[model samples]
Target: MCWKKRFWFLWNARLQPPMPDASKGVGHLWNHNALKGYHYFEIKTIRSSNMKRITTLAFFACLILSISCNIYKEKKPSQVHPQLSPLEKYVAAPDTAFRYELRSTLPGKGYTTYVLYLQSQRWLSEKEVKNPLWWHWLTIVVPDEVKGGTGLLYIGEGSRKTELPTAAHPIILQSALATHTITAAVHNVPNQPVEFTDDDFGPRVEDELIAHGWRQYLDGGGTEADSKWLARLPMTKAAVRAMDAVQQFCKEKTQKEVSRFTVIGASKRGWATWTTAIADDRVVAIAPVVIDLLNVVPSFQHHWQAYGFWAPAVSDYVREGIMDRQNTAAYQRLIETVEPYTFRKRLDLPKFLINAASDQFFLPDSWQFYWNGLVGEKHLRYVPNAGHSLSGSDAIESFVAFYHAIVNNEPRPDFDWKTADGNILINTDPQFQPDSIWLWQTANRNARDFRKETIGTTWTRSPVEFSADGKYKLDIEKPAKGYAAFFVELVFVGDGPVPFKFTTGVVVRPEEMPFGDYNTTK
Candidate 1:
C-alpha cells in the first residue's frame, strides 16, 4: 500500500483509545506494521530534509496519539484466562460459515443505520440440520459523532424478521450518539421458536431450548460434545460473529477496525453476555441485565428455598426433568461446558450486573450465590420497582451511563459491601461520594416469594445517613411474621448523561429456610 493509504489505514486502525503499552510510540506502530519500515530515526531524518512534509506527518501522528490518550487514558486490555476452550471452539468453529449482506440503510436523526441480513453460523451438525440455520438481522447504528476503534454490541431477542427494520431502535441510536461509538444490535439470539426434528422438540426459544439441551444431555445419554451444541453455544456465537461482522463492515465502510467492545444483553441475552465475555477477548466490559441466576446449581437451590417451589419463570427446566438429574455426571459436564459460574475465573472484564428487585424469574437475593466468585471490577443494581421486563424504569439510562464509562475509561465507584450479623455494611471510598443513599425494603408476610405479581408494588425506600463511625449501615430486624428483603442503594450522578446506581446484594431477614433443602418438586 502507498504511504497515504497506509496512513489512512493506520489512522482508522490505531486512532482510537490507546491500550496500556501505547506510549511505546512509532517503534511499536512499526512492529504492528502501522508503519512497516518507519521508525523515530526515519522521522528525524525526514524532518531535517523536508520541513513541510515532516510537519504534516508529525501533525498526523500527534493527532492520533492525542485522541487515543483522550479516549481511554491507558485502558488495559481484558485479562483472558486460558482455561475455557469449549466456548472458544464454538465461536471459531462456525467462522468459515459466516456471511452477511447489507440489506438497507436508513438515515436517522444524528445517525446513519445499516441493516444487514447476517447468517452468523450454521450450528449443530448435518444430522441435526432439521433445525433452522442460525440467521439474524444485524443492525449497526453509527452516529455522526462516532469516532473510535471501540463499539458496543447488544445481544437482543426476537423471532426472525424477514423484512429489514424501518429504523434503528431508539435506545441504540441514543447510545451511539451518547457514547460517540458505533453500536450494533443483533436479534434472534437463539433463532428461536425452533423445532428440532431429531430431538422431537418443537417451537422452543430462550429457556425452553436451554432446558431441552440440559435434558438431552442428562437424560438422553448425550456426551459432553452434544452438550456443547446446546442453545447457548449458538446464542453466544451470534454475538461473537456479530462482532466479526461489525468489524468487517466498519473496515469496508470507513477503513476502521472495531478492536474492542462493551457488550450488553438482557435476560437470556444477558446470560449470553456472560458467555460471550468468556468466549471473546475483545470484550472490555459487560452489562448483564436481569439474568442473575449464575452459579446455576446453588442459585436454583436458593430459588427453590425462597419460594418452596420452582417459580413459574423456571418451569421450562422443571418440565424437562432437569431438576431431577442434577446429580448425574452428564449434568455436571453440561454445567462445566455452559454455566457462566463455572467459567467465572475467565471473566476478568469490568461488569455491570443489573437486575430487577421484583424479577419473576429470579430471587432478589440470587447474587449471593455467585457475585463474590466473579473475578473483576463489578457493579450491581436491583431496580426497586421493576421485574423481569424492567418496564417503566430508568434501567436503560443506567446501561447507557455504564457504556459511556467503559468507552471513556471512567473509573467505577469504589466501595465494598457485605451482609454481616443481620446488617448490611458499606464502606465507600473517600473519593466517591453519592448524590443520595436510600434503604429499599419490602415485606412478604404470607410467603417467602417477592414477585411483583404476588406481592404488588409494596417496596418502599427511606433515606439513610452514614453512622458516626463513617460507615453506611442498615440494621435488619427480622419480621415478626414472615420474611422481609432489603438492601441499601447508593445513587451517584457522574459527569455522564445519567446517574450511576449501585447496590448491596439483597438480604432476606430472619434467616430461616421455609422449605426443605434442594427438593426435586414443589
Candidate 2:
C-alpha cells in the first residue's frame, strides 16, 4: 500500500462513519461479554424511535455502562471490602495429604523486615545486603482450625489496608480458608522519576514493578527518583523471599515441619512470582496472572507495535535500548543483573498461568511464548474476555484450586509446547473437538491504539490441523517474516453450531518458533 492508502486507513479508522444500513429499521445487537459475564447493549440502529421510549431506554443503557465500568477498577484498602468468613470456612477438616507443622515466632513489634541477598549476580554491597530492598511483611496464620502450614504468599502490589489487617488478600481476604492463610506483604522498591498518567498504569498501586527496567537511566546517571523498578533491588527481594526466606518464615511460624509453599500474584507481582520460582527451587508451584513478561524483552523488541510493555518507562527493553543487540558491557551487566526475560530460558516449575484474553495493558499476541518458556509442569487456564484481573466470584476459588492441587501433589496432566520438523505441536489435556488457533497481528509497529484496534486492526485467525488423539499443530507457510504477535490459541469447536470464543493463549514470536517465518511474512 502507498502512503496515501496508509493515511486513508488511519483516517477512516479514527473517523469511521455509521453503518451503511443505518437508514433501515432499528437493529439491536445483543453482545455478550463472556469475560465480564454480562449482556451489553450495542445500538446498531436506533431508527429514529419514539421520543419518550427512546429517552427511557437511553437512560437504562447509560446506567448499565456505569455499573460495568466498575468491574475493571482496582479495589483499594480504603474501599469497603467484604468481611472475613468464619474460621471453619477457610478449609475442610484436616486432610492428611496437605499436612505440616506450625512453629515460627513473629519478629518486630508490628511488622518484620527480612534481608534479601542477591545471589544470581553480585551488584549488592554490604549495605544493600543488610538493608536489602525490604518490604514490611506480616503473616496471618491461624493454626487453630487447620493441620498443615500450607499458605498463599501474595506480594501486595495493589493493597495498602493489610499492613496490620488480619486478612491476607486485599479483595479476597474473606474467601481465604481457615485451613489456609495468606502472607501479605508490600514490595518496598523505589519509584520512577516519571509517572504514567494512563488509566491502567497510573493508579500507582496496581503495578508496583510494572515499569521495571532502570539500566538506561541509572547506568548513564540520567535521572533516578524512586519506583518499584529500582533495578536489582526488586529481583533481589522477589528471588530471596520466594526461594528460601518465605518458606523459612512459614517453617518458623508453624513449629512443626512445613512443606513447600505456593506463590501467587498478578501484574508486577506476577513477574516477581516467575523470578522467585526461577531463583528458588523450593516453590511447589506458582500461579501468576495477567503479567506475561517472561520472554517479553526479546519478543517486544521485534514486535514493538503489538507488544509495547505495560510499563515502558522502566521496561528492560526500553531502558537497555529496545532494538540494540545489547552486547555492550553496561547493557550485558544490566541484563544479567535485573532482567527477568534474561533467565526465562531455564525456568522449571509447576506454573498455572491463569491469564485472560484482551487484557488492556498487554497485547495478547506478544504473550505467545509466555507459557511455552516454562520447562516445568505448566497449565494454561485461559479466562475469556477478562482484563488484567481476570476476576469474578470464582476467581480466587480457581486460584485456590490450583494451589491446593500443587500442595497435595495431585496429578497434573502434561501439555506439550514444541516445534518439531516444520510443524508446531501443541498437545493439551483431553476434552476438545478442535477449531483453529485465532492468531492476532498488529497493523503498525508503533504505539498500538488498543482502544481503537478492532478485529481488522489487531486480530487475525489462522486455521489449525488437528489429529484424532486431541493433539493439534499449525504448519507455517514457508518462513514468514516481519514482527507480529502469533498466539497458539486453541479454538475449541463443539457439536452444535460452532460458537467460537478465544481463551488464554500460548503467545510466541515467529522468529522464536522452529519453522516460524514471522520475520519474512507480510
Candidate 3:
C-alpha cells in the first residue's frame, strides 16, 4: 500500500468509526488523517462502531480535565506593606505619584529659634503601586550637638492648615523611617518662643506654596528684634545650621549628593535670602523681590524713630560712623561677596532680582542701582501695579511662573508690559484720528483729573450730537453704574470743511447699592 493509504488506514482504525470501503471513501476522508484522536486515545475494540465510541469518550475526558485544572488554580494577592495605610505609603514614595510633606528645624540666634516646614506632592506610578511602602531618610546638621539622637521633627497630617479662602491646604508629615548617617557639629542658641500668625505675609506665602506642591522651611520662633539682630550677625552659627539642615534634607530625601540649593525670598525676607546666598557658596540661585539696598539706610532711621532708646546714633551718620557706615559697608560687601549678578559669570550659577514698579517701600531707582552694578547676565522683571506686599493675583502668578521655571527646568512664557505713555485712545474711524473722541474716567465722577491738575472736572459723558458750525468740546459725567455713550462730529485740529461722525462707549465701575435701593422713585 502507498504511504498515504497506510496513514489513512491507521487513522481510521484508531478512530474506530464505521469505516467505509476505500472505493466508497473520497476527498478528505480518504486522502487526509480521518482519526487524529489516535494521538491521545488508545483503541479498546476492533469493531469500527466501538472504536468510534471510545475515541469520543477520550476527547470529552481531556476537555473536562483542562477546564477543571483552570478552575482549581488560585491567584496571588498584591504584595504591599501591611503596616502603612495606602495614602501614607503613597505620599512617602519619590515617584511622580503622590504628594507628601516633610518637616525640619534650623537653629536661631539668641534665645530664639525657628521651625522649617516642607510639603511636596505628585502623581503615582505602577512599580510604586506594586510595592507601596515609602521610605524618606533625612540627615540634619545643627550648630551644636543635640542631646537626643532624635533631631528629626515629625509634623502629623492634622497639622496642615491654611487661612486662604481656597480649599487646598498643606500636608503634614507624621513620621519618617530613620537611618544612620554622618553627624556634623551644631551650635546651640538660647531657645525663645516666637509666634507667627496667619495674618502675616510669610504664612500667606507658605499657604500659597503648599497649594502648589511646594515645601516651606520657615525658620521661626524669633521676635522682630531677635530676627533683626540675627540679620546683623556675620555668618552666625544659626545660619550655618539652617544651610546644613537644608543640605542634609536634600541628600537624604532624594538619595542624591546635592551640594548646592536655591533660595528665594520676597519683601523683607529678601534680606535673609541675600545674606544666605552670600554667606554660602552651596547656594545655586538667589532671587530677592521688592528689595532695595539703599532701603537699609532708611530702615535704620525708621528703627530709631520707633524705638529711639534701642537705636544707635552717630553724628553726621550719612557721611561716617559705624552705625551708618558699617551697614552701608556691609551692604556693599555683601553685594561684592555674593556677586549675585556675576556669580553666574564666575561660578556658572544663576541670580535673579525682581521688583515692582509701584512698590511703595522701595523706589524703582533703587532697583536700577542694583541692576546697574550687576556684572553678569542679570534678569530683572518690574511688575506693573504690584505693591510692596505683592499680594495681588498678578504678582503671585508671576512669582509662580518664575519659580517653576527655575526649579523644574520648565519653559517661561513671554509677557507683554504696558507703559504709562500708552493711552487708551478711542478712534471712531480706523484711518482718521480726527474722527475719534477720548475720555478719561476715574473712580469718582467728582474726582479731579490729577494728570491735568484739574479739580472736580468730569469727562464721563457721552457726546449726544455735534454741530458742523460749532467748536465742540463737551464733557458729560455719567452715573456710576451705567454705560455712557457719546456721539461727536470731528474735524481737523486747525479747521476744515470736512466733518466725520463718531461714537464711543464707556462703562463706569459698579456701584455698591442695588438700583432699586438707590432709586428714590421706588
Question: lDDT tens string, model 1, 271-332?
Answer: 89998888777788899999989988888888777778888898998888988777667777
**Global fold similarity of model 1 (TM-score):** 0.82
Better of 1 and 3 by lDDT: 1
Residue-level lDDT of model 3, residues 112-145, one tens digit each, is 1222221121112233122121112122333221
Candidate 3 lDDT score relative to the true structure = 0.30
Of 1 and 2, the candidate ranking higher by TM-score = 1
Q: Tens-digit lDDT track for model 2 on 363-422?
A: 554545455555656666544335565645244556655555554555544445565543
- Which has the higher TM-score value, candidate number 2 or candidate number 3? 2
Candidate scoring better on lDDT of 1 and 2: 1
Ranking by lDDT: 1, 2, 3
**TM-score, predicted candidate 2 vs. hidden true structure:** 0.50
Q: Which clashing pairs does model 1 show? A: none
How far in Å is the alpha carbon of 27 misplaced in model 2? 56
Q: TM-score, each model? A: 0.82, 0.50, 0.32
Worst 10 residues of 1 by lDDT: 26-35
What does each candidate score in C-alpha RMSD? 11.3, 25.0, 31.7
